[model samples]
Target chain A: MNDSKFPPNTNRVAEHIVGLPKSGIRDFFELVNAMDDVISLGIGEPDFMTPWHIREASIYALENGHTSYTSNLGLLSLRKEICRYVKSNYAVEYDPVSECIVTVGVSEGLDLLLRAIINPGDEIIYHEPCYVSYAPGIQMAHGIPVVVPTYEKNDFALDPADLKKAITPKSKAILLNFPCNPTGATMPLDKLKEVAQIAIDNDILVIADEIYSELTYEGEHISIASLPGMRERTIFLHGFSKAYAMTGYRIAYACGPVDIIDAMMNIHQYSMLCAPINGQEAALEALRNGKTEMMRMKYEYRDRRNVITKRLNEMGLKCFKPVGAFYVFPNITSSGLSSNEFATRLLNEQNVAVVPGGAFGKCGEGFVRCAYAASIDNIVEAMDRIALFLKR
Target chain B: MKNNILRLLRKNARLSVENIAEQVSSDVATVQKIISELEDENVIRGYQAVIDESKLSELQVKAIIEVHIQPQRDGGFDNIARRLANFAEVNSLYLVSGGYDLQLEVQGESLQEVAGFVSSKLATIEGVTATATHFILKKYKEAGRLFEDGAEYERLKVSP
Candidate 1:
């Protein structure tokens, strides 16, 4: 074939596709790595390794020659274990065979759902400041992302009134993430009920990302799926990454009505055959026998959460007391700088890393997010540097 | 008299409290107290001098960073968010409800600066699995003010 024989390239990459950038935490780490000495409190991943047993299970799967691709819906054993775990822990039910599909990660599950359900001009109601992908993914799927801005004073809780206001005739779905990422905020059961009622009345689907359901520090983590009439309407996304610290393994699953699951499965079948075979085995093992490890990690996180909350409050940062997640979203508007200005100065001057709130959405401009997944020593050191930086 | 004085002061932030009081027939203490309250409530967030950045010609790059994270066990994302909340470079961070778990706004002088921050700093963290960055092109409207105000169309017409 002649070189340059292919049709001349004309169209730019689809207008909806967005590129992923390096995370702010990664940027901060680069600075830390180059410096003589630095402490970092950025990023929200667990510092602990995947439990030894979970690792061993993956090893066992590999050794037993379970490397081939499993069913598109994922390995039966893992899905069954997920069903048990969800029912026992979250009070939600799913049939492993027909209503669930294994995904590369929650990320992939999100992509699949958006692709499967969204039509051009569909409205996606979501909370903000939210996980970054919801809006962009909606945009890419040719959907409009209507953000319901949660307030820091309200502990980042969603307001039913706001949700009502954001709804329109075109509204297709509402995305909920309890035990949320940056804010570490969880929806109370009553709020979840109210949200469910709203979703039901509006005939909207509820895409609930409960990947962090197991990391709650307060009252029980309530799944929207468990609410009355919500199981039929809500698509639950969960994964072994956060609970098992298996982020690198990229194993997650989604469960909803058969139609939605089938649609998502179509996307999964075309894009990714299945989650890694080893990851599926590891996730199954973790679900079955990792409760103690999960509890231990949760307690350690609680200790770190307490220390950081107290210390930051002492340092003049007004932080909403987080109930479930390990993050603390504080109001930095009082600091006399924009969230971006504060974060940049802190990293450049104090060698500390953090993400600015505005990156989440316009409503998030006044605050910053701090991840305390680091050790006590790193948190303490980073806080001291922050104190000094603030003093200066 | 009071209304007129209030209008005058509203028109000019540089007017001293004493100057406003003199015009309004009020005491300086009263004027000072009102201004103080406004500042405290952040109705007037802060005073700023509009700098001519062209003199320095520094690079102004804005990027949106999407972060995926798992909430820490027991403590959830609170522990992780608080640690990130203190950094200077982070303008804002949000726990969003979609594909990427967290969204962050970062401002830097160059793309390299942002990329460096992401790869060396953010990706290395434990909870963050992947990040996607979107660089802002032109801010058409920010804080409710239109930037170009239909000028681009006019410019294109003239050029063509």
Candidate 2:
């Protein structure tokens, strides 16, 4: 008898491991991590810790023997809090019991949603220069990925005409991410309405990732799910990551139609019993009592964003002012260097690590994504180093 | 002078130095010198047939597709990228710099046909995460050819 417990050779394994060709952010982090006294501007996650109260709550939960798995949909209280949170903050209502499912993180929520909705050969519509996970997730689900390129002149906003052109009979869904990663651009209410109209007209489902809803600097973040007739068609993803600096907690939630939620939960149940019990407890505390902490972090991020934007522009880099999230995407094409070259050189020469724009997508070639989640001191030092590099 | 030479080349790539000089009303030496420089730089690699768009009514709709992807365990995006590159509808494939990972330039007869290619063909492939599609509204410029002459001047005049 063979004593080896070998994994099956399923073709599905090949399909699951997409998007490995280019992971510049991960590379940048590794490089930075390996360097001594490196001033890294590469990471997208917040530098702050989970709030004290939220941490305490998780500790309490663990101490009181709340370690077992909750419902497949997650703790009812957490789902209820998510419902209330979205409704109060963005005017979106979701049925706590039927419509919402707690996820390990927004990343996992995205994976589950794709697994639930995408069939082999289905097409998913998304904009270029978007978050990195969307395409690979679609591929893992055996779905086609379609990209609509957004122009930097438009601050990377989705254009309706462009969307209209991309639609085909094969399109099953669209993934919309606002307060977007890399760019930090947020869609206005009118734009959200337009996107909703497009989705309704085309009979397409939408997966709206609004994880950075609580971190908007210019105006309140709008939810596509809140639009008329959008609630049924939209799956809204949110989490305690950006707003509460709970990156390590890895807790997130998705709210959508009951059927979709159920499908996603089915996948979630088998794949990972539930989001970590501790993470769920911590997220609950975050939703309940971490509003002040959220605001404080948001303010800090906004301030840093402004500082970075001003400094980058002053140094002759063309940077669009990001109204949400904590990233500044500055066009470094004028430097006469490709994005990868600039990023690699910056990291190696100046000890400043920024993700090259090309790492995000082709449209990002001339740009560099510098996350401003670090402290002001780091930001200032990084900028100074960058200026020296540019001058040279 | 260069514009005239370019225009002549666009019409017929195989034109000789004397023939091009005659067409553009320039001396043979000047035209031949410019042609040599363009060739030396490899910008004018070699000219091929310029197919008439109207002749190929079979290819109608043109689109730019943005694809997001994740890495697979063993194969990664290489296999998927190669698969997409192999599609007949794909004119160009670019590994992009922004939100989406891959950019594909594709063509079809109708929007539905392109959609079919996406759904029935591209999406079904393993390792694809998400996709967004943008259709070409107007060809303002392509392959260094101006779509609408004087449009830029008109806009500039209207602005002030």
Candidate 3:
């Protein structure tokens, strides 16, 4: 049944889509899944279930006949709740009607934002050793991703100079994910002001992906848009996934200037149409009443962070204590093996799976991203296994 | 600082000092010292697990007895309260202000033991006037844990 008339490459995939590199992490996800006893310290989702109250609300919404696409901008009530939440917490205001659009997740929100704004070859500057989505997301939007590899010595804080160097006439926006993912770094207000000033001076847009805003351990996470003169140019990507432990709900939103959101919503209506109606209801419940459960989970993460950070350091892995997020990126240079080599051996020998830092970005070698979201007993046991592996 | 540690310990007595110190953001030594001082000062009276007796085959009976008592010239209800607390069967005693002067939570190996404790011991107190004992049929929630009508937490052992 071979169609011999057409050549193998007669019809080609889109150049941009074909050029997107396959994620190295997915291979490890599969490899770990095949093994019987492997401990997955590799996943980035929360170990906690979505709170009972949020689940109940979503169930009620379904029973009450909300099983349809919401408005293009999502339910008005949900947008209002999001606006109130940001205004109270970050002290930044947005007109919910004009400035907010509920997207499938930050995953979709980033895609929509990029397609809305980026012309061919428009450059987006982002911090490196970052979330795996940044580069591919930008590529899918037909934008060139300019990566600035932050140093571990600086605790992975974006150096204003490095960010400035990456900017040019072609640079359209700065994409930032603070309280960062793989590195577990957070940008304090002072550091954020420096970047904000640079963005203001350059007249470039700011794309702040503050999805982990609520999980900061030491101090409040400053939304870069909150700084003066920055609000007008900043597009905020935030959601209920990390904070409310609602990752599976696929609920997230974007808030920016009226013009930009309108542009994004134009694409959203044609593609995603609208976020799930029940997810919007659950998100509303999370914003209004999920504070206690959020704090409870945050408390658990903090304990895990402390134990893992201290244990890794004590074991001579030289981990920079992560003040935010649930991951601990520890330098494994002393092991004398490449990050992939170490991760593979650790899995094959000790049955503990950690994502190699190399999976994140080129500059991320000599380390591994160990998510501390597991129970304390597992974390302790994994650390013991790692220590034994190192010894062997 | 000490109060925060005590509060956390109240929620989970199984919490290690290392865990409590991490949450409160104090050094391990400082937390250890504070906890020891609290223990020496008798601020933390004791800790016990809240178990679901129904889950166990070795069943027990629980009863709450309300006692009306005349006030002593010296100790008021405190006198009867302390005397009631000394009994082996009394799990908890509170000087209540409603129709009763004292409320007792009593637990024993069987229904007969609880009944005997109420009739033979608790009623013999000099100031005791009348008694009403109520048997507990079930417990919905205790000390922040839900026994029934609660979802099991089935989070993946580890997730991203």
lDDT values for all models: 0.78, 0.82, 0.88
Q: Fraction of native contacts in model 2? A: 0.00
In model 3, state the lDDT of residue B16.
85
Encode model 3's per-residue lDDT on A107-155: one tens digit a residue: 9999999999999999999998988889999999999999999888988
lDDT of candidate 2 over A245-348, digit per residue (tens): 99879999999999999999999999987999899999988888898888878766765676688779979998888888888899998889998889889878
Q: How far off is each candidate at the interface, as Cα RMSD in Å?
A: 23.2, 23.5, 3.5
lDDT per residue as tens, model 2, B68-123: 88867877667778889998999889887888888999999899999999888888
Docking level of model 1? incorrect
The segments of candidate 2 whose C-alpha lies over 4 angstroms from its true place after superposition are A1-29, B1-160
Tens-place lDDT per residue, model 1, B56-134, is: 6677777888887777887787766666656676778988887877788887888898888878877787777778999
TM-score of each: 0.67, 0.68, 0.90
lDDT of 1 by residue, A1-392 (tens): 33475554534445455243324444444444465444555565776779989999889888999889999899998888888777888787889999988899898999999989999989999998877778878887788888899988678889888899998999999999888877888887787788899999999999999888888876788888988899999999999887788877999999889999999999888889888898898998898899899987886676567667766887888896677766888888667999878988987898787778876677888888887777756776787888888788
Could you tell me the lDDT of residue B160 within candidate 3?
Answer: 33
Model 1, global lDDT: 0.78
Highest lDDT against the true fold, candidate: 3
Worst 10 residues of 1 chain B by lDDT: B151-160
